[model samples]
Target: MMADHENAGYRRLFDGDGLTFGTGFPLTDNRTSRPPVERELELAAHAESVGFDALWARDVPLYWPRFGDAGQTFDTWPWLSQVAARTDEVALGTASVVLPLRHPLHVAKSAATVDRLSDGRLVLGIATGDRDPEFDAFGVDREERGARFRESVDLLRTVWREDFPQVEGRWGDLDGELDLVPEPTTESLPLLPTGHARQELEWIAEHGDGWLFYHLPESTLESYLDDWREAAGEKPYAMAVRSDLADDPEAGPEHVHQGFRAGTAWFREYFRRLEELGVDHVLVSPAGESPEADLQRFAADVIDRL
Candidate 1:
């Protein structure tokens, strides 16, 4: 269950001990080109109305031709702000923001702005970064990214939580001169670190409010959850999956990249298993031929049943 002290974003997705569900942006089948922005907003509102606890957007700063998929084709900050304006409830999240590529100060300011605009409904997911070409393109030393990642997280926390806080690190030096304007709805917005971020599990647990990782099988998930409990007891753990729902509700499972092609019956059992394994939240990409219909079906057939 969500603790009383956690902010709106944290509580909305994890307000209880059972599993909660959320979906990502781009709300359409066309990944090669831009999606219809208006339609995306409609689907986002629809998602909230149908009982999804949160809505996520990805941070793909540069569209690498080889990478082949542009995430929402919009920058994270403005896109989230637009989404925030359209929806009244439902927590807003970045599937993750690449901390190493962007300046921590800008990240802190933008996040706080969105958090305030959305009425304390932002859950910021930070990552060390993944794409090698992006690292080179940004002129950031890939080897030093881990250190930068650590530095950025430390810096962001201080700036958000303390007024005119003093800090010095590889990123830069701050001497309690000026504060970042427009503080978050809470003292600080929750930061959920994505994947390992080239740090020890212990370090992640100590610094992050929660953990966001890719999908895993039930056994692996249970193992990870055990480690999580030892490192950070009761701190929420979330995972993501890319799903393609089958037409038959009773159809069985077939493995795909980091997810599955399954039917409603299989999804229900799988989610129930995740709940048993202590997974606090699940972020899904329901990529059926008709995405809007898929979302509705998943909510009605799977989420409602759960």
Candidate 2:
């Protein structure tokens, strides 16, 4: 069972100095249209060998045609379990799991099982979910997901803490008072909220152990950090970026999503800038083909430099 480290405080899991680097799973190959899950694992193992801190996967149920890219292209739980068994030291994280779409008991059980198997090396990132098609297909109301996300979080926590816990919330009520067996190794799971998710910034600051932000320009990163710190008091913060690395060392910057398309040299410099701005960890998604090769090269060259 999880311990009682229930005090609300920001826990420093990754510092910018050591610098954790992670790549999304089932890495896409825009050039050849190949998804090399095995190649991705080989590269992830290489990342662990080189001292990259974590590996992340996304829970993308339905591929929305409008949403340019399909993330990871793997089921979240099985992928994470496979990665955990393959690697020994690197931490495992979900870029995020859409909380409102899943049952809280399932979330608690699956996450705890992975945590135990990983020997307490799981970092859970939760979100209210953004895809309209997924909500529609699941018969879940996108409009009410924010409220459901909050309730789901509460239920998961309650189940993790008390054996056969009874939960009453907007999502539903559990009356069995049945315990969720095999609790996580940590007293409380390390859950970082992705964006505000309909919750006020103050509530996010007060409740979230860490906050996850999407795209923010370099100029505004510091100011945003300041606002987040003000609301968060002392909690840590994390961010994700869609990056594509160029083979040409002299390649100029190209626009991706939250990140720039640059050579390894420029990527290294960008991470340094983030560290200077007090960003703790930056989860990078490779945007083009050769994600595995690019990530391997990144771990060997750019990641170590930071």
Candidate 3:
């Protein structure tokens, strides 16, 4: 069972003794175009029924065709709000919201509202954002993303925790006048800085409740975990893995984009190794013709075994 956290999402994910599993959006197809969103709720609920721990959505502000992925093709707040309404037990989150692309006030309000809607089941993953074309389109200075991301994090925490407080930043100034309403169910939302967000690992360790990263090799991950333990000491670490399961359960591993294409038996051992290395959570993106079945099989094969 999961332990207690001020935020239900955090507790469900990090307040545990071993590694856990979650899945990303567009769970059905691995395409760059629009996804089968109509089926997402059904699939999401099914995932929860089958014992998936969390469900994540990506924040792709625009569908920059030059870049190959369109993400979930829905706004994160509304999409996650509905996901929250559909599934009661699974935690809901953004794979990582592009902090620099959005204003902090808007991001804070939307996140808090989702947390309330989900009964405190929102764990926000934030990032500085890539894609120069997107930055140009949004009229955001691409170079300032790192700095803006820092400001956004600080501002989000401040506004969520305080009422009508004085705050100033490059985004704008919030004098002690009005307040951002419907504060989060918790004092503050759980923020997981994704992909470094262009900050020092130490700073990420110091400020973020956890860290969200892409899939890395075991050797590299071990080195990273060693550094993390030295700097942050037990702060939960999460990563995303793109996977494909083979028909034969005995097949060995093959290299894929962010993760490996392996048989269930080998996959289970891989996850076990991740747990032994102190990974707290993993966001798995299923890549197969039958994603829903893959979801169930993976839960049975790997998650239950863990």
Candidate 4:
């Protein structure tokens, strides 16, 4: 199914035999406001030069001070557009765009614009949203987010693939009078639905281009993938881990939130286990005081050998 995508991003990252690694943006452990823009660009360029498969950004609209982390502290479109400009070949992705919080038309337009500009290197990961206060702030009923999420996905696909498409839903309606401009580089932009988004696993498998999942233990993930394969069949599954790679090569793994703190050798064995569990790709968050140095070490020590 990944071969169905014409985009270089999907082809390079998901259409391969073994696992490929990508680093999440902000590339730092600084859970503060904005990350240094110049440093991010420089590190991104470094990531590309080292044969990293992709670079991912998160969409955090209104930073809930209570929630902390600002998610690269830059808007998804402009940040990714800038990332696209800085790197020539590495894939660009949104770890997710909260679809329930934004209008699908706006999302479609921005996505199309970026895809066109990037020469077909965008991979969109969509979500139903997680922050509760932010939902109230956006004036959207959190209870109805699931329905809205489904409707938004439908709207996005229709807009991208049809001319003057007719779409009527709880969100809004289009009478097929005016068509959207700048269609995606491919017939449809590749979409990976993050988490359940309040939908059934079957619904996700049936509707989404791929599945974007959060970190799980090895046993749990292996069993989950078995169920996923039954429903989704050849469609790819991607997951992320919040990792802190230790300086010592043989340091054992210590559990952390959603991931672990380990050395390069431990990570190497762990990733090989992930591949055996049927994980198609991984978004690795290199957590350290010096993110740039950590990333370089990760590339040279772990990824290059893998």
Candidate 5:
């Protein structure tokens, strides 16, 4: 059985860490060409073997060609459930699920199922969603997504905590009330908001367990951290970086999205700087490289170094 979020075990898993490390899936180039799902899982297990702390999956319901990045080729719910079942210790997380596109009932059920299967190792990241095609396909409005996201989150929480909780929101209303049976292993699942999503810092700090950010420079990171701290009070912060490590030790820093293309030595220094800046966790994406080998190399060369 899973423990509650307030449980000591849960705290140790998420916050009481020696700096957690994890990999984001997609296993493909921005062009959507790369290894298969089996290869990706193999690499994910290898990441666990090499002492990584977590494995994160992304939801890409619709691949917008212009968006450049088609996150993890598979659907998210099943993928996360499978990954959770396969891995023993590594925490499983969704880089984010587009809450506005799916019903809160579905979100609560799916997340609870994963958390139960993973023994409370699930970290749920929620987002308002940006892809217009996905919204259109689901017959939802893109402009109203932010409102929907807040409503869905509120409803999901109610379903988890209260028995037969009623919900009313812009999307719709649940009058009879519904409870998520076989509640999450943890009393409450950790929810990290991806980007601002039209929410205020105060709301994020008061409600979110953590914050997830994209690529930002070191200078920007400092200010962002300050803001996060100001709002978070005591909650943790996480950031993702895209890296392509090379064999050359002296490779100069090449600009990537939120990270850089550098050798292990530079990578070590960069992570150390992030740690110094009070980042609680850092997840990396193997930008256009062999997912398994590159992630393993990074774990051994960079993660282990810290």
Candidate 6:
């Protein structure tokens, strides 16, 4: 499945035996155009203290008023660095960075910088840019994203691993003279492609360090996991679950936002079920009014039980 990638973040996550839980930023309420992040750092540290394994940040480049949700708001680099400084050991992740919009060399530097700053606690979840407006703003043709994504991903791996490595692509060429400094502390960074990223599963299985799939039904996820196992071996499989934790522990399941609205009891069982299905890690985006309280409750009530 996966090679022995020494990324601290990837190791802490996929290296474990059972399913592990991590929470994403905008810690609560995914509907706001601007998230109140005053306590976000505090919640992040608290989440680490409470047994959460990772802290994920989103890379929503622009706020589309129609969508009314600006991901974590702050640029992922500084934000992740801040989170890295606040927490000691939790793996810090980007839900998925839009690769087509940015240059690979920049990604290499930034990602490696964060990796060094955090002592290798970085797992990059990458994807082709999805929003059309984003494409237009970045002047990248949407149709070209698939190709650009592949180029960037390939280039990132090469640049990080080789010193002044000879390479050329749609982005540019690197002669054997110039090197990208500050190599990642590990052999290489962990690359988890989100969704399809416009590449086939086979491509992802081969090139990516792991996979970051979106939420899917149990049967569907099981089938997908089978395909992944067959193609990728034991490489870790991760997914996002939009959770609306009801106050009642016995609350039954109600489908919502590619996830569920359920009591702690149901959610706990659900997570265990996912673990049984061979899921390595889950990134949870909690929805509630009081994010800090909601996160703590979710950890104590659901994650703890699992």
TM-score against native, each model: 0.96, 0.89, 0.96, 0.97, 0.91, 0.96
Model 6, residue 84: what's the lDDT? 93
**CA lDDT scores, all candidates in order:** 0.87, 0.74, 0.88, 0.87, 0.76, 0.87
Which parts of model 6 are misplaced by more than 4 Å? 1-4, 28-34
Instruction: Give the CA lDDT, 0 to 100, for residue 49 in model 4.
Output: 86
After superposition on all C-alphas, the RMSD of every candidate to the true structure, in Å, is 1.6, 3.4, 1.9, 1.4, 2.6, 1.6
Tell how far residue 182 is off in model 1, in angstroms.
0.7
The lowest-lDDT stretch of 10 consecutive residues in candidate 2 is: 2-11
Q: Please write out the lDDT profile of model 5 over residues 180-262, one tens digit for every residue.
A: 67798756788888889778888888778788888789999899999998877757788888778877866778997677888
TM-score of 6: 0.96
Model 1 clash tally, residue pairs: 0
Off by over 4 Å in 5: 1-13, 28-35
Model 1, poorest ten-residue lDDT window?
1-10
lDDT of 1: 0.87
Which model is ahead, 1 or 2, in terms of lDDT? 1
Worst 10 contiguous positions by lDDT, candidate 5: 1-10
**Regions of candidate 1 where Cα sits further than 4 Å from its true position:** 1-5
Candidate 2, after superposition: displacement of residue 227 in Å? Answer: 1.0
Give one digit per residue, the lDDT tens place, for model 6 in 147-231: 9999998898888877779999988889899998788987679999999999998999999988999999999999999999999
Q: For all candidates, what are the clash counts? A: 0, 4, 0, 0, 2, 3
For candidate 2, write residues 135-168 as lDDT tens digits: 8888998888888888887787788777766668
Worst 10 residues of 4 by lDDT: 1-10
